[model samples]
Target chain A: MVADTASYHRIVLDSRPAGRPTADNFRLEEVAVPTLEDGEVLVRNHYLSIDPYMLGRMSTGVSYAPSQPLGEVMIGEAVGEIVQSRNKEFPVGDHVVGQLGWQEMALSDGQALRRVDIGAAPMSAHLGVLGMTGVTAWYGMTQICSPVAGSTVVVSAAAGAVGGVAVQLAKAKGCRVVGIAGGSRKCKYVMESLGADACVDYKKHADSAALGRAVGSHAPDGVDAYFDNVNGWMLDGVLPLMNRFGRIALCGMISRYGDTPMQLSAHSYLLISRLRAEGFIVWDHLDLWPQALQELTDLLQSGSLRSGESIAEGIEAAPAACIGLLSGENLGKQLVKLN
Target chain B: MVADTASYHRIVLDSRPAGRPTADNFRLEEVAVPTLEDGEVLVRNHYLSIDPYMLGRMSTGVSYAPSQPLGEVMIGEAVGEIVQSRNKEFPVGDHVVGQLGWQEMALSDGQALRRVDIGAAPMSAHLGVLGMTGVTAWYGMTQICSPVAGSTVVVSAAAGAVGGVAVQLAKAKGCRVVGIAGGSRKCKYVMESLGADACVDYKKHADSAALGRAVGSHAPDGVDAYFDNVNGWMLDGVLPLMNRFGRIALCGMISRYGDTPMQLSAHSYLLISRLRAEGFIVWDHLDLWPQALQELTDLLQSGSLRSGESIAEGIEAAPAACIGLLSGENLGKQLVKLN
Candidate 1:
C-alpha cells in the first residue's frame, strides 16, 4: 500500500548561472507533497527532460527565448505515472502529463498536462520522441523549413533529441538530409538509424569550412533547408552554401552554451540573398501539437523511426547530467531518471 | 552646337570599394554610342540617381540583385529628354523615365521607358523623391512595414536617398520617426526637415549598443517598424530595444557592400523574441510602383516631403559621385547632371 504521507522533491533556481550552469546554481529540497485540488494529479516523475534551452534561461543576456527567473522551479518537462487523483476525470493509476518540472513527485493543475497513452510506446518516450522535442522537430521542418521533395536538408547538433528527430522527418519528406554531430559513433547513428544522407563529425574537422565542404559533397545542388540547433562559427559555413530562397528553422544554439558569450559573426547575408530564416519557440506551435503527436506516434509504432535516451539514473544525478549536456558529453536525448 | 554625332559616357565599375565607397572605385570612359535602331529612343540624361543598392551590385558576393558585370556601365535610374525617337510611343522633347544607367545618353529599346508628367513636380524630382528610390521607401512603409499612426518608426542610413523619403513617409503616416545617419549636419536635416522625432550619428557612436542607447533617449517607447538600409552593428543596437512583435523590413546592407567577403552579424535574437523580419526586393513589389509614385508626388507638392540632391556636373563626374554616396560624403540623394 502507498504511504498516506506525501513526499515531493523540488530543484529550485538558486542563482543566475554564469556561462555554463554549475551544480551550485540549483538547490534541491524535499518538501511535503502539495494537496491535490479539484483537477489535479500526483505524478511520480520517472524521467525529466534536460534541454539546451535551459542554458538560455540561466542567464539574463539576450536570447531567442526568455530567461529563467531566479527563485523559481527550474523549468522542465517530466513523464510520470499518476498514483493519486482528486477528480473523476483523472483516476488513480492513470498516466498523466504535466509541467512536472525537476521534481520526484508533482501535484499539478490539470492545465498544461494531458493523459499519455503509455500503451502506444514506453512511458519515457513521452519525454523525448513523442514529446516537446519531437513536436519541435516536426513543426520546425514541416512549417518553417518547408523543404520540398528532393531538396537538401542540413541539421546541426544532429544526434541530440530534436536534431535526431528532425533528420528522420526530413528524410520522410524525401529530402537529402545531412547531419553535424560530435564524433564517429553518433555520426554513425545519424546516418544509419536517423536516415541522414550523410553525417559530418565536427570534432574530426578542424577547418571552419570543413562542414561546408562536406555538405557540398553530399548536396551538390546546395541546401534548401537548414535546421540550426547549433549557432556559432558553423553558421558561417552554411550561409554561403544555401541556395536562393532557402529556409532556416532555428531550433537551438548549443555550441555557444558555455563560457563567456562568444563573439558570433552575423550571417545577415542570407536575408539579402533571399534566404528565409525564422526562429520559433516550440510552445508557440501548440496548435500543431496534435498533428505532430499523431505523425510521430505513427513513425515510432511502425518501426520507421526509433528514439534513444542518454539517461542518468537517480534524481540527485540530475545536476551532473545537466552539466554533461552543456558540455556536449551526453548523446541522443539527455534525461535524468528517478530510480 | 552640342555634338550631333553619337556621344558616350560610362559609369565604370572601376574597383570593389571598402568600408564606405570612395571616389577611387569610380572610373569614367568615353566611347562611341551605337547607332539607334527601329523601336529605339536616343535620350540625353538630365538627372541620374546614385543609390545605395548600386554599391551592392559592384561587390562580387551573393545578392538578390545580381552584381555589376565588371567593366560595364553602373546600373541606375535616370530622367532623360528624348533627343531622337524611332518608336511611336516616345518622341523628341518628351521627358521619360528609363534605366539610362550612369551614362550621358542611352539607346533604349523604348520598352522600359515611361513618359512622366512634368505638371506633378520638377522633372528632376522624378530622380529623387518620385523615382524608384521613392517607390522603394513608400512601398516598404505603406505596404510591407504597415506602420500605424504614432508607431515608433526607425530608419537606418537616415540621411540617405531611400531613408530620406522613408522618414517623411512614416511621419506622414503619423509615426514618430527616428533616423540613424553619420554626422551632425545630416542628423539635423533628418530631424528638422524630414520630421524625424530623433537622429543618431553612427560615426560618433562606434558601439551599436550605444547607438541604441542614443536612439532610446529620443524614443522612450521601443521602435515598431524598422526600415533597414545599413545592416551591421547598427542593427545589433536596435534589436534588444525592439518592442514585442515589431516588424523589420529588410531593405539593403549598404555597409557590407564594400568589404571583401566577410561574415555580417544580424541579431538572431529577433527570431526567438517573436519579432518579424522580412527581406523584400523592390522588383517583387513592382506592381505597387505606380500607386507609390502618386502618393509621394502629392506629399512632395504639399511641401510635406523634402529631398536633397548632390548633383555632379558632367557624365565623367558620375562615377566619383557614386563612390561619394557610399562614403557618406553626399547629403540627401546623389545625382548626375548630363544636360
Candidate 2:
C-alpha cells in the first residue's frame, strides 16, 4: 500500500555543523507530493546547484540571506520542468530555474521561478555558467574591478564557479591573469584551461607572504585588479602585492567561513597602495543580468568561454558533493543531477 | 660660544621607537645655515606642522613614501617667509609652504615650495586649514565617501586636524555628522564648535560593541558614510552599524600605528552590506588641491568653517608635542610655532 503512494525525495538540514560540514548535517527522506495550491506550479527538478555561498546559509549568523532553519528543506537553486501549473505565466512542460531547495518535486508560487530556454544552452548551464555564477563573475569583474588591458589581474579560488568565470573575463579583456587555488591540480586547470598567465598553489604555500612572493614572481609589476574569494591568507598575500590604485572586488570569503574572525594588518598597506576594496552580492545588481546572461550564454555556446561541471548523481549525493566542492575536490561548478 | 653663532635649530630622527616614541628619539641641535644652491631658496619657518604622519616617517616600514632615515633632519611641511631666494620662482619676502622639515630655517630648491598669500588666511593657516590638512579632508569627503545631503556621516578622531575638517565639510553638505573623539572636551568641541550633530566619547566606551551600540542609538537608521582615521576598535564599532552600500574613506590608521597588526572579522558583514572602502593619500591628488584649498580658504574667511591649533613653542618642544598628539592629549591641529 505504501509503495503505491505518490512520493518524492528531499534533503533537509539535520543539524548545524561545528565547523566544516559533514554528511551527518543533512538528512534525506521520502515525503508525499503536496497538492499544488492556487497560483502555484509544481516542478520536477532535473538539476540542483550547490554553491559555496550556500555554506553561509547553513550557519546562524548575520549573512546577506537569512540562515537556513534546522530541520527545514535545504535552501538551493534548481533547474526543472513544470509538471503542473495553475499560474497563467508558467504552464506544464515549461523548463525553469528557481530557488526550489534540494527536493525532487517543488511547488512554486511562480514569482521566483523563471522560464529557461533549453535551446539557449544545456539545462544544467542555467544553474552554472549562464546563471548566477556567471553573472557574479561578469558584474564583479566589469563593474567593480574594471581591469584595463596589460594590467595584471589576480583571482583567488580561480577554479571554482565564480572565480573560473572571473579569470576568463579578465583574460578576455587582455589583462594578464593570475589565479590562486589549492593543490597543483586545480592550479594547473586554472592556468591551462582558464587561460591564466600564472597559478599560485595556495596549499603548497604555508603563509600569505610565501603566496605574495609567488604572485610577485609572476606579476612583476604587481596585481592591478583582484577578485577575492578566499579572504584569509590569500587576501593578506594580495594586499602587499597590489599595485598603486589597485581595485579589489570581494566576491566570497570561503576560507574564513568556519574560522574565528582574524585581524587584517594590511590597513597600512591599503592606505599606502591607495586600493579600492568593495564587497558585493549579485542580487543587488540583478538589473544587469539580462545583458550579462546574453553575453555569457553566447560565450558558452560559441566555445569562446568554457564551463566545467563536477556533478554528483541522486539527491543523497548532494551533501558529499558540497563538502567535496568546499574542500577543493570539485574542478569547477558543483551540481547534483536528479530526475 | 655656540649660542652666539649664526645658526638655525632643527630636529633630527635620532632613533626609531619600538612603539610609543620618547623625547630621546629626536635631537634638536643648532647648525649653521647652509648656503642656497642654484634654484634654491632660504626660508625662516614661522610655523612648523606636526602631524600624525610624522610617526610613519620616524619608523622603518613600507608607507606611501620612503621612510625617513635615522639621524636625518625630520621631514615636514612649514609656512614661513622666503628670507632669501636665488630662484626667480620664489622671490624674497614671499610667504610660502613647503616640505621644509622640522626647523627654524630651511633651504628649498623651489620645486617643492609654493607661495602662500597671507591675505588669504593667517600664516599658520597655511600649515593647517588652507594646506594639506584641509585638502585631505576635502578630497576624502568629496571624492571617496561623497555623502549625500541628509545622510549620516561618522568620523573617527573627530577633533584632530583631518577629521575636524571632515566633520565640518560633511556638516556644510547638510549631512548629519557624528564624531568620535578621545575625551569629553574634544567631543564637546566637535559637537558645539564643528557643528556635528553628535559626538561619541570613544574613550568612555571600553569595547567596540558598546561604541557600536552607542552609535546605533544616535544613528538609528545606520551610518551612511564613515571617514576612518583611527582603525582599531573604532573601525570595529562602525563596521557593524554601517548601512547598506555605505562608503568609507580611509584617511589614517592611527590606532594600529604602534600596535601589532590585528585581524578584521567583519569581511562577512562587508559582503552582506556591499560597502566600498578606499584608502588614499592626498599627495596623490595634488591636482584637486588648488580648488579644494580655495574653497577651504573661503570657508575659513567667511567663518563658515573654524580651525583650531595646539601651539607648542620652540623646535625643542616638537618631540613632546608629537607624543602628546599621538596620545590624544592635543585638542586640535598640533603645531610647533617658532617666533
Candidate 3:
C-alpha cells in the first residue's frame, strides 16, 4: 500500500552530525494526521528518496537548499498517493510527488505536489529515474557536458542513480562511455547492463595514481567529457587523463559533501588543459526540467533507458539506508518504502 | 639602444628545466641577421616581451602554444621597426609587432607582423599595455567574467600585466574593484594608481584562511566576479568567500606552472556556490581582437587607461629579466630593451 490512515510514523532531525551521519542524528516519532486546510491534500508517502545531496542539507554549511533546522521534520522528496484531498485538482488515489519530508503522512497545499500518472510507469520511479535523478542526468549530459559523437565520456559512481543514467545517455548519443564504480558487481552491472565500453573499479586501485592508471587504460585517448559524481580521489584520478578542451559537468561531490578540508590538486591541469569546470545545482535549471522529463519519459517508454531501485521496507530504515547509500552499500536510487 | 645592426644578438632555449628556470636554460648567441626573403621583412626588435605564458612553452608539458624546442630561437613576441622589407604591406621604418622571437632582428613573412603606429602609442607600449596584455585583460573581463556595474570584482596579481589593466577596466565599467598583490608597494600601486577600491597584500597573510579573511573584509558582500591570474593558495582563499552564481575567469596559474603537484581544496565550495570557472587561451579568441583593440585604443587615447613597463636593458639581460618576471621581482610588464 502507498497510502495509509490515522497516526503515521515520521522522522525528524534530532541533531546535526559532525562528520559522517549516524542513526542517532534522526528521531522517529508517531504523529497524528493533520487537519487539512482549504486547497490542501493529505498524502501518505509511499517511497522516500535518500539522495547524496541531502547530506549537504543535514549540515551547517552552505548548500543549494537551506540547512535543516534542529528538531524539524527532515526535508526530502517522496512519491505518494493522496489519501485525502480538500483540493479539487488532486483527487483521492492520485499519485503525487513533492518535497514532503521523511513521513508516512504529509499535508500539502497542492502547490508543492505534482500529480503523476501511475499507469505509465511505476509509482516509485516518479521518485527516481522519472523524476529528479533523470532530470539531473539529462541536464548535466545535454546542457553541461554536451559530448560529441564518438568522443569518450567518463562518469563516476556509475551503478548509482544519476551516474547510471548519464552513462546510458552518453551511449545513446553515439559516444564511447566509461564508468568508474566501487566494486566488481557494480562494475559488471555498469559494463554489461548499462552497455558501457569499459568500467574501472576504483576500489581495485589502492591509491589515486593507481586509480588514474586504471581509468586511463579504459580511456586511451583521454576523457573528452566527464560526468563527475564522486569528487575527492576520483576527481584527482580523472584530471590528468582529461583531454585538452574537456568539459566536466560537476554533479555531486558525495565523497566530501559533509566533510570539510578535502585534499585536492588539479589547478594546473584545469588551466593548462583549458578545461571548463562548471558546478551547477539542478534546481537552478527548473525551466529545462519539463523538457528533460519528457525526453527521459520517452526513453523509458522505448526501453532505451533503464532504472533500478534498492528500497528499505519501512520509514524506520531511512537513516540506515541513507548511511548505507553514502557508504556505497546500496545500488541505484536508495529509498525507504514508508507505506 | 633597443635596436642593433652588426652581428645581432639572440637567445635560444638551451635545455628544459625541472623546476624554476635559470640563466642556463637560456643561451645567448651572436648570429648574422637572416636575409629578408620575398614577401618577408626584417624587423629590428626594439623591445622583447617576457610573459608568464612562456614558462609553459619552456617545459615539455602540453600548453596553449607548442613547447620551445631545444637549441632553437626562443619563441616570443616583440614590437620593433622594420629595418628592411621585401613586402609591400610593411615598408622600411614601419613599427610592427609579431612573434619575432628573442632576437635583435627577425625575418617575418609579413603575415605574422601587424604594423603598429608609434604616433598613437610608444613602441614598447605595443609590447605591454596596447598589446597582448591589454587584449588579455579586455577578453577576460568583458567576455568571460562580464561583471555588471556596481558589482564587486576581485583580481589577483593586480600590479602585474594583465591584472593591472583588468582593475582599471573594472573600475571604468563602474565596478568596485579589489586587488591582491605581493608586496606593500605593489598593493599601494594597485590601489592608488590602478584606482582599485581596495588592495590586499597576500604576502602579509601567512595562510589561505588569513588571506581569505583579509580579502573578505574588503568585499563584505562577497566577490561577484573574479579574474584569477595566480592559482593555488590565492584561489583557495577566494573560493570560500565567493557569492552564489559567481563567475571566475581563469587567466593563468602562474604559481603552479613548472611546479609539482600542489595542495588544493574547494571542490565542495565550488559545487555549493554554483560557480563557473572557465580557463581560456586568449589566442583562441582572435576573432574578437580588432574590436577589443579599438576599444582599448580609445581607452588609452582618452587617458582612461594607464600602462607601466619594467624594462631590463639589452638582450644579455633577457634571461635575468624573464627570471625576475617569473619571481614577481618586477612590477607591470617585464620587457627586455634589446636595441
The segments of candidate 2 whose C-alpha lies over 4 angstroms from its true place after superposition are A1-6, B1-6
Per-residue lDDT tens digits of candidate 1, residues A117-203?
999988888888899889999988999898888999999988888999999889988899999989898899899878898999888
User: After aligning candidate 3 to the native by TM-score, how far in Å is the CA of B75 from where it should be?
Assistant: 2.5
TM-score of every candidate: 0.89, 0.95, 0.95
Residue B136 lDDT in model 3? Answer: 94
lDDT of 3 by residue, A1-339 (tens): 534456788899898988778999999998888899889999988899999887888887766788888898889999998989999999999999999999888999998787888887998888888888988988889988899899999999999999999998999899999999999999999999889999998888987789889889988888989999988878888888888889888898877855665677765677778788888888889899889888888988998888878899899999999888888887788889874
TM-score of 1: 0.89
RMSD of each: 3.4, 2.6, 2.2
C-alpha RMSD over true interface residues, model 3: 1.8
* Weakest lDDT window of 10 consecutive positions for candidate 1 chain A: A260-269
**Candidate 3 local Cα displacement, residue A207, angstroms:** 2.1
lDDT of 3 by residue, B145-176 (tens): 89999999999999999999999999999999
Please give me the DockQ of candidate 1 compared with the native complex.
0.35
- Residue A101 of model 3 has an lDDT of 95
Colliding residue pairs in candidate 2: A262-B263, A262-B264, A263-B262, A263-B263, A263-B264, A264-B263, A264-B264
Put down candidate 2 lDDT per residue, B1-339, tens digits, no spaces. 124326988899999988878998889878998887888899988988989988787788777888888988999899899887899988998999999998888888888888899987889988888899899999999998899999999999999999999999999899999999988999999999899999999888988889998888889789999999987677878998889999999899888777776556565567778999999999999899989988998889888888888899888888999899889887778898885
The CAPRI quality class of candidate 2 comes to: medium
